[model samples]
Target chain A: MRELAKMVIVLTVLSSLSGGLLAMLREKTQDRIEQQVLEFVKGPAIRKILAGAANDPIADRFTLADGEAKRSFFVGKYDGKPDVVAFETFAGGYGGDVGLIVAVAVDTDQIVGVGVTTHNETPGVGAAVETDVGFIRQFTGLDIASGPKVTKDGGSINAISGATITSRAVCAAVGKAGDLYKRLKPEILKQLKTFSG
Target chain B: MAKTVTQEFVKGLWAEIPPFRLVLGLCPTLAVTKTVEDGIGMGVATGFVLVCSNLLISMLRNVIPSKVRIACYIIVVATFVTVVELLMQAFTYPLYLSLGIFIPLIVVNCIVLGRAEAFASKNKILPSIADGLGIGIGYTLSLAALGAVREVFGSGTFLGNPVFGPSFQPFTFMVQAPGAFVCLGLMLCLMNLAGKK
Candidate 1:
């Protein structure tokens, strides 16, 4: 009984100490982490797409809304014109989830750009999403008219060689994003116009 | 005490390698080893977490109750993981973003948990720390080797720089998921062969 009591006391003290240390660490870094996440999500990719725009990037101005399943995003304005709105989709990839960021030009109803925010696709092959600038750049001006197919299917964009599954996954995600944009464009534009006025 | 500490540290490298020999922490081992840099980053992060957690757990081994040991270990491990994650975010944002969910997932990595339960729970603090370092280094070395194989064949690059020059035709398939398995399997086979010799 004495041994057991001693054990219990030691365990309790250790747990408490460790917990307190963790709490202190979390408090110290929580704000910095939040800032880092914000910068990462909105940094280079958003800037790349919104290059030369009179207004700030949509990621900077917009608020993200969580729906039942999907995420909806609204960007404020560009040069007094509501130019972009985005929607994020989570797609299953070869290794894990892929987060696709699709930004649309509200006025044109065309894709402004598409960025892969997160992916666990194979490193050199499926992960070409990040490494292959040309492949991603193809999405810049594409829209419903492009029909989102690989070069093998006579489309303009070339798929990453030897990573058909991952390439197809990205293609499908972009296609879906385009479809969603088409469906949501009218309402999004209406909201933008009201807000701008 | 000195002999025991030496044993604890040395054992992790060969007798009980975290991934190759012991087959612990396979998830992160396979998931983040696409690039040499990522592999090294993950290895270091995991090592830091492992060593700290092992020391703390060892110090508290006498006190934690048997019935709730697992829960207490998890909480302790998670706290360290969170600290590591935040540090990476602040100091190595690009690498942190590249690692993504795998960082948080480290909290559940079997190697850390396994040590906490099997060894640290019954060991002295110094020996546990040595064990953690040895195991962590073994795991890191394995990841670096895997990353080197994938990066060289798949992209003709070593650590993000083109090694074979532009003229070399890279084997794109080597960086895919299948390649991870193939590389690991072949490595295991080689290790077994060396042992036989």
Candidate 2:
């Protein structure tokens, strides 16, 4: 009984010490970690997409909404019009989750740009979605009417070589994002008008 | 005392290699070893945490009760992992982003807890520190070797730079999940061959 009591006391003390240390460390770094994650996800990609607009609204000020299974993005204003309203779409690829941040020009319903956010595909093959500028660059200025299909399938955009699965996945994700954009456009436009007024 | 410490430190390199021999921490070993750089980053981060946790755990071993020792060790290991995570995020954001969830998952890595129970709990502080260093080096070398094999063939690059000449047609599949297994198996075969000598 004495040995068990001693053991319990020792364990309790050690647990408290370790927990206290971790809590202190977490308090110190939580803010910085949140800031870094935000910057990493929204840095250069968002800026590049919004560059063509006449007015540049703060990307940081944008609000994010999670719908049933989609992510809705609302950009405040660009010049006299809503800059771009977007929905990020995700799909499973050969490696893992492939996410695309897609924005459509509010005026023309054209794709502003598509950014490959998360991917774990094979390097030089599916991973080319990030390194191959041509694949991503084609998304810019493309309207929903163009049909988001690979060139081999009789569409305008070419699929990445040796990474057809990942390419197809991205293409499919962008197509879904476009569909969501069209569905959300009316409500987004109303919200934009209210904000502008 | 010095001899025992040396033995504990050196044992990890051969007798108890974390991934290849012991088959512990296979998740990060396979997941982050797409490139030599990422492997090295993970290895070093894990090494730092291991060393710190081992030292602390060994020092507190006498004070921790046997029944709850495992729980106490986990708390210590997790605290060190959080510190390493925060430090990497602040100083090495790119590497941290590349490592992603695997960094936090280190808290549950069998190798860390394995050493905490097997060696640190019964050993003196100096010897436990030595054991940590040895195991950490072994883990790092294995990851780097794996990463090197994958990056060279899979991408025709080493550490994100083109190492192979332009004429080299890279085998894209070598960097994928299947490739991880292939490379690891080949490495084990080679290690076995070396052991025979």
Candidate 3:
């Protein structure tokens, strides 16, 4: 009984100590990690998606609260006005959660571009979705309020050859982003004023 | 029978080196030595975890119940690995991306648990630090040496720069998995030959 108590106490104490240290370290590194993500992961994707924008989209960003979570929005100015906004959304994919960044023309509520930010999909098959230019371009100019779907699901978009699941994941992420955008459109527009060049 | 702190430190560089002499922690040793940059990055990250965990484990050795020592050591090692991952993601995003899944896998690397169990658990704090530092540096040196050989022969470049003239042809086999095995074997043989005297 004494040995059992000692074991339990030691394990409990060690786990909690480990947990506490991690939690504190996470809190301290959260902002810097977020910044690094912007500079590395999101930066290239956003720059490519929001191409030709007069202002740097990555440097012009803001966050708005939706419910329990805060979502960041990157602003792109074209012809000296903050006309476009971009954000990330996720959905289940072939390997795990697939992250897709969807950019929208705020005035018309039309998708300007779509890009994959992170994924664990199969290398040559599902991963081809990133470089599959024609498929990605189809998302552009689509109505942001209307949920987009692949052709098999009775939508205009065609799925990538041999990667229907990953294609569907991207569609699903855009659909979820549509719902999020509709809910937060008012707050997003209000925040965009400050970023306008 | 008493060994000084200097001896403990020196042994890690050659005698009891984690990967070569101890023949431990071969996974990262095999996977990340494709480039000198990547090899050094993996080594530094592993060394940091090994040292931090060793220090904390030695400090807590007296208080931890022997029955739950392994569990306690894991908690400590895992916590430090996570801390390293978070910091890398924040400050060295490129290295973090290049190293990928291996950063989190450091928790399972036996060198850490081996040191905690064999050395830190019974030794004083200073010697434990020495052992961790020595083994860590030795591991780093071994990996860098292998990385240099592979990079120079495989790609005809050293650290991404052309080491040979432009006319030189790269031995592509040196960068592949089979090459890693052959290189490691030959290096191991050489080490054995040196130690035989």
Give the distance in Å from residue B88's predicted Cα in candidate 1 to where it truly belongs: 2.5
Per-candidate interface C-alpha RMSD?
A: 3.1, 2.2, 1.0
The TM-scores that each candidate's chain B achieves against the reference are: 0.96, 0.95, 0.98
What's candidate 2's DockQ score? 0.37
DockQ of each: 0.28, 0.37, 0.78
Clashing pairs in 3: none
Q: TM-score, each model?
A: 0.64, 0.67, 0.86
Per-residue lDDT tens digits for candidate 3, residues A39-126, read 8988888999988898888889999998999899999999899979999999999999999899999999999999999899999999
- lDDT by residue (B4-29, candidate 1, tens digit) is 77888988888787688888788887
Candidate 2, which segments miss by more than 4 Å at Cα?
Answer: A52-197, B1-7, B14-16, B20-23
Residue by residue across B1-197, what tens digits does model 3's lDDT show?
77999999999998998688999898988888989999999999999998998899899888888977888898899999999999999999998998999999999999989999999999999999999999999999999999999999999888889999989889999988899999999999999999996
Candidate 1 vs candidate 2: the TM-score winner is 2
Tens-digit lDDT string for candidate 2 (B1-197): 44677888888899788797888999899899999999999999889888998999999888887787887788789888988988788667889988989999999998999889998888889999999999999999989989999999999988899998999998988889999988888888887888785
- Tens-place lDDT digits, model 2, residues A97-187: 7987777777888887887877889876788887688888888888854558887777777888888889888888888777776666666
Output the number of the DockQ-best candidate.
Answer: 3
